[model samples]
Target: MKKSTKMMFFTMMIIGTMITMSSNSWMSMWMGLEVNMMSFIPLIYKMKNNKSAESSMIYFLTQSMSSMLMLFSISMNSMMENKMMILLTISLMIKMGAAPFQMWFTEMMNKMSWMNCLILMTWQKMAPMFICQMSQEKFLMSSALSTMVGAIGGLNQTSTRKIMAFSSINHMGWMMMCTTFNNNLWIMYLLIYSTLMMPLAWMFNEKMIMHSSQMMTNMKSMTEKMNITCMMMSMGGMPPMLGFLPKWMAINSMMESNMYMIMIMMIMMSIITLFYYMRITMSTMMIYEVQKKWMMINQNKNMYTSIMLTMNLLLMTMMMFF
Candidate 1:
């Protein structure tokens, strides 16, 4: 892709975000979403690989369907003298790839490059989540169920991208829970998540591939191993890292709200999540010189530096709170 084209695409995504923020009507929100989708299609194609193309197709179709459903729900609400929170909530849940509709997320992650996966994981999430929060009273059940499903589903993913996909879904549950609390918490969670995740994606993107097995023997130095450990721990929501902060805040907030049932459910699921995270962390940290020879490609230094630096800083930041 040309420099001009990249600039143009980003310009449109920003415009779409602006439009969605300014508008109360669903029509304007739909337009903004289309703009965002259109902008990203180019980034997906920039890789020029078949997998990228395939992932792009799936993402576009799924997003289009969700946008259409949102429009239809809004129209229906207009006619019914009031909004049907259930329909709107379901649409938002589908868009966010929450429970009962999370297949698309896992599938897309399986097919995309690491960098593309990162973009999908982070940037693509805000709009749908915002829309869902807007109608909190209408979709609380779906949100609650999505939280449970996301936590459980992430427990067994083998692929790195699939793991992150489920992690995003899991975190979505936490983010949704925050909606019931206060706007300050919601914004804080978003900020902290974005701060931590951008580097995680960058770290993985340095590798280009999405399988933990592929990374088993790639790093030769002790420094690289430690950096990877930090990232994996951050994702696991372990103490002394930024990731742990959100989960802790969320649990405390839930308990404070007297939502004991959901709180206990989240705690159990979180323990399950530790297993998946540990699998990756173990691979990255302990597989330095395993017996079997594994085929690997040239390491990308630029990608590695960015991920390492950003993640270490995030880890350090989290440790300060301890």
Candidate 2:
């Protein structure tokens, strides 16, 4: 796509998300979702990649069906009806790519470029999750199940993108749990999650990486390896890392709310997610390299990589006072 055209679609996409988030009615939210989808599909395509085009189609169809369901539920004469609420919740879960409703999400992510993948993983989630509402039981069930599914789904996968897709699902579960307590908590979780993801995604995109094996053989610099390792560990929500802070806060909130059952489930699945994260970084840690910098792509190491990595640790430090 041309620069101007891309910019236009991107702006519209942002506006669409804002519309949905700010809308006071379900009908308006549904309209915003449609606008967002229309704009995003264009951005997901490349000049000649038929796979990307196919991915866009899948994304469109899935989102369209979900939106249709959402509209139908909203059009019901009484919004308070139990059946309408259930249908609305299901549609939102489908749109958010929560567990048992995320097959399209995984398929779409596999064929997308890194930038598109980042948008799908982070930005695209905002509108649906922003408006998500349901009973505590539904929230708890979605949270526990998504966390477990995400953790198990990534274990046997070698594709880096697929792993990240699963990781997003895992974090989606956490954010869902966050909703059970307070909206601000999930917003905090989302911000922290996005912070950890950006640099890792950048590194992968720059290196043209698609598998864990690439991290071992492709990233030759020690700095590269260290950065990637720490980021992955943090992403896994391990202690003393930035990612752990949000999960920690979430668990604390759940504890205060007496949500012990789902809390334990999330913690166990988190450990499973950490295992795959370890698998990805273990080889890099084992290998010794003498290169003095991060990847030297375009003949210059992007200073922002380390800057973002440091930002993570700095955030982790805030956990000490809490």
Candidate 3:
């Protein structure tokens, strides 16, 4: 793709996301989504191959399905008044890939570039998240259930992208649970989660190639290895890190609200999720994967510096939390 075309494509995506996020009505939301979809198609094709095409198809289909559901729910709400609540809840849940609707997330993560994965995981979420906030009361119970599913689903993934995808879903659950509390706390959680997660994903993308089993092979220096390892722990919500701050608050909030069952479930789920993150951490830091004699690892100074900077910021942010 030409540089001019790439520039135009990203410009349009940002514009579309902004418009959709600012939409007052459901129709405008759909329009924004359509623009985002169209702009992203070219970027997806930039890879130029069968697998990329297949991945684009899957993403397009799922995104279209979710958009249709959102439109249907909006129509349903306009007709039935009270029924709008349930439909809106269902639509946004579908959009966010919460629970039963989450298969597309993992599938897409596995197929796309790490950069694409980061965008899909973070930016694409804003619209549904905003919509979910609007239908807070109607969606509370469904939100809790989806959160539980997200927490558990992330526990077993081996692919790094899938792990981040599930982690996003898990955080979505925790954020949804915050809807039961005050707006101030909810916004704070969102900011903190975004602060930590975006850098984490960016760090991962800078260091690891998609479909590669482990990233340590790509790390050329001890500093790079240490940075990546610390990042894995930060994403796992380890204490003294910004990631842990939100989880701690969620647990405290759940307990205060007397939601013992959900809190306990979350605790167990966290433990399960932590195991996989630790596995990746070990691979990247403690136990190096020995490559076959014939295999070669590429080391680019620019990529190494970029990832090292991201990892440093993540660690530095966590340090600030303490």
RMSD of each: 3.5, 2.6, 3.9
Candidate 3: tens digits of C-alpha lDDT, residues 52-115: 7887888788878877867787778757866766666666677677776788777777888876
What do the candidate models score in CA lDDT, each in turn?
A: 0.72, 0.85, 0.70
Question: Arrange candidates by TM-score, highest first: which order?
Answer: 2, 1, 3
Once fitted onto the true fold, the runs of candidate 1 whose alpha carbons sit more than 4 angstroms away are 81-83, 289-322
Taking the tens digit of each residue's C-alpha lDDT, what string does model 2 give over 1-322? 7899999999999999999888888788889999999999999985449989899999989998999888888888385678777888888899989998989888888899888999999899888778773233247788888999899999999999999999999999999888877457888888888888888898899889998888877786666777788889989988888899999999989899888887898899999999999988997789876355463453324564556557765875786667
TM-score of each: 0.86, 0.93, 0.82
Which of the numbered candidates is closest to the native, going by highest TM-score?
2
Best by lDDT: 2
Tell me which of candidates 1 and 3 scores higher on TM-score: 1
Worst 10 residues of 1 by lDDT: 289-298
Candidate 2: residue pairs that collide: none
Model 1 steric clash pairs: none
